[model samples]
Target: MSKKKTAMPKITLIVLLSISAVLLILLGIWLVGELKDSFSDPADGTEPGAISTSVSGGDEVVMLVNSYIADMRKDKTLTIEADGVSVKLDLNEAGAPVDYDELESYMKSKGYDTALIGQYKTVLEAQGEPGSVYNDEYITKKIDELAVNVDTGSDTEYELIEGGVTFYRGSERTVFDKAALADSVKAALDAHRYDTITVSTTKEAPEIPDLDELYTMIYCEPADAYYDVDENKNTIVVDHVVGYDIDIELIRKELTEGTWTEKTFMKQEILPEVTAETLPQKYFKDLLGQQITYYNTAEKNRTVNVGLATAAVNENIILPGQTFSFNRVVGERTAQKGYLPATVFQNGGMQEGLGGGICQVTSTIYAAALKAELDQVSRYVHAYKVSYIDLGMDATVYWGSLDYVFRNNTEEPIKIVSSAKNGTLTISIYGKETRPANRTIKFRSVVLETYMQEMKFEEDLTLAPGAEKKIRSGMPGYKVELYKQIYVDGVLQNEVKINTSKYSAYNGLTKVGPKPVVTDPPVTEPPVTEPPVTTPPETDSPVASGTTGEDVPVVETTSAPDPNSPGI
Candidate 1:
């Protein structure tokens, strides 16, 4: 309060001091920013305030990266050089190994912006040089060049060899350098990518022919020695020869010398392994097991299928310790092979499908095999119960997946005699029956659990009024166990457990009346009425007659006058 006289001087001094302080702060900030800009490195995404004394500027560096990207993006061609010829393959075709998206992503990660990317693509398309993308065409051309024709056939006229069969034999060609060709192609492709390429001109013959078809063609099947009970004759049929097969591996070895020589007549005669003299007395002479399968005769197609399958298995021989696959023996089931469409169980329901009735033949054979004491290799039970055979003893087979397999466990080879007649499928196993004559084998199924089907009702409009019809009668499901029981001299010797099978329940189906029932009114009957009584005219009691004591009206001479007579 005492210094009020000099207030204006004090205000001017404070204003000047404030302005100078602001100016100094601003100058310090400018100096700091300039120093940071000068020392910043372009590699760290920091722009420099001034160019460096050495090294290219940012624009030049960007131009270099774009050029590299353009070089990588150029259209590539795969050139396969071999046999003094260059095979130019366009890389834009199928099977090419380029990834444009991946390259673009990699370029972007290296700080390539959209403008630079577009500019690089333009330059890449403008370039005339083709990038390299080597592949396998070189091997193919070289292999063709080194290929040589071979004549391994004889000039002898075609003759039906002892087996009464003939097939044409022709010259065969081979490539000697097959292995080297593959290696060379691989090496060439690698060498284009800076790897060493190896090439060769030596030729190798092609692999030997498959002999399975030839063996089957040349094989002469021997007739099985069967006993004919009707004639009481043990028909001992003479065995025949299964002639001639060439050793494919041996031929390949002989041909490896690279000489195109005519094949030598390398033939080997095959003799029947089983004959009447070689047949075991106990094998194929006595019946080991027999089983019969019954089917509905109304299923004509299914019956035919069963017959076909039976014929396929008829007289089939199983060598000792050899496994028999049902699918392999019967082959594929198709309409072309004489199988027909019939109802089969599939996917938890009964459906009409191909190869339906073959299961009957399989089940019959399974029963016979069980009785023969053959070892079971693989078997599957049906999802639902089959009426043709007992529960747990039935076998169902499907091609490719499900198969009925069994091995002949006996020392003697076994034979199967199958026949289908009048909807009856019978399978018999004949082998050396070593068991005691009094001993018998039987298969019995034991029921463990039974499932009663519940009735299911549904409305159906196709039925008569107030009618209820059963569409399907439910079959009771069962859990059964099969047992192989053996008896010797009329006494139970032992019981062997075979398998446990569970069958799913099928519900009973019923069709009921669709609409509510309509009833008629009660009928009314009329009451009984008797006819009215009628009284005769009153007649005076006639005086008592003298003799009869009866009143009788005396009739005048009742002869009516004729018309011709005059009325009086």
Candidate 2:
């Protein structure tokens, strides 16, 4: 304390104030690591200390982030889109685009981790350019990975949808036929190998030239058929006349399907639409204005099983999404197929069977297909009313639950010819021969509402009250209502909804009796004791308890009503 005076020596002012306060605390720790490397990685665009890049900086900062990811992937392309379809990241070839500002100039000269090496510098920015990568990892490299980018199409322009079915027709010569032939739209390929960079659609479909022997056996030879864009529906076959015969058996049993479409294809041309100048006023007014008839009381022997009103036809034509089937061409009516019995509807009434009364031949071909408006493909509903037709405009079939189907769906092709003996069933659906006769349907029956008859009790018979029989009267049930009235040439045009026929309520079976057939208490004869007459007491000696040698009248037996026993 007393001699510490040497302390005043002050070795050069304390070594220049301790080296200037250790260089001001190492320049404030190098200015706080240069402001923490400019805020760690303000998106790694470099500029801070100019060196220590955080990806732990190794391989010379992986060679300056692989030379700015090779000028940011040289010929880039990118593109990308969603829902409405679009895609193009063509990573190579003349395909490029993902430079995004040279990925921020190589995430700022990669002091290594511009986000863990920016996923190896976005595949060195998807390689078409940027190099110095180890030795071509698929022509480029650098690992440090982390992936999950979906939205496919990085390989090149993409497209994939595939669903279709279209059929168009609006002719005098084309309106929108559309499918010239990208293989006419039937794609189902899967050759695989990543679509080998996609490119396989040469497209073709030619064969459709027989236009009835290529234009009537080369008649003028100039009868063209050309169809380019490769050819399928772009169909350009110029012309071919007369080709008819419809009734597609429900289109060969619903859609000319397969097992190889079961035999059916043929083309014709005989009078296409009856042109020899309209075939004599179509036989003087559709064959003398058909008078409609079919009266065949089962040819004498009677009993139903007839195809009687054989085959007859004045005409028939249909064309518009066209299709009308009925066992193809009404082919099964037999007497060995000659067809001739008449009258039908068996079982629940008018008994006869083997096509009895052919539904009066399907109700006279359904009131000539509803006076030629024709189109009722599979009808059925005739439990009773079979006086030819009429009744919600009659249409019946039992084969497949009612069927009279129809379809001109219409623009042309229609013609049906029919005719049958003594009485009638004339059908004449001809078409396009000046196109007149506007329409005339008329059925009109009106309020035929009559129900209440589900009694189904079978036999509760106890008859004879007023003794006046006939409870199920004449079995002539009648509750009819038919309305379709649509006349355009004769005026009155408008009345639709045509279907309401139910005549199944006929209850009349007279002969009613006196009621109470069995109330349980009626056989009273149990007290007739003729058996104890002095009893057999004096039996032996007298032996005649009221004279009994042969008078065995003990009368005491009656017990027959107990069917299963239980009656209060």
**In TM-score terms, which candidate is top?**
1
Cα lDDT tens digits, model 1, 258-322, are: 35434443456555565555655536887888899787667777777888999998987777777
Q: Which stretches of model 2 miss by more than 4 angstroms? A: 1-349, 371-383, 386-392, 395-414, 417-430, 433-445, 448-476, 479-484, 487-505, 508-568
Q: List the residue pairs that clash in candidate 1.
A: 175-204, 176-203, 176-204, 177-203, 177-204, 282-432, 283-432
TM-score of 2: 0.21
Q: lDDT value for candidate 2?
A: 0.42
TM-score of each: 0.44, 0.21
Residues 440-531, candidate 2: write the lDDT tens digits.
Answer: 56667664665544322233244332223333332344566566777787898688766666766533333433442323333434465577
Clashes of each: 7, 67
Model 1, CA-based lDDT: 0.63
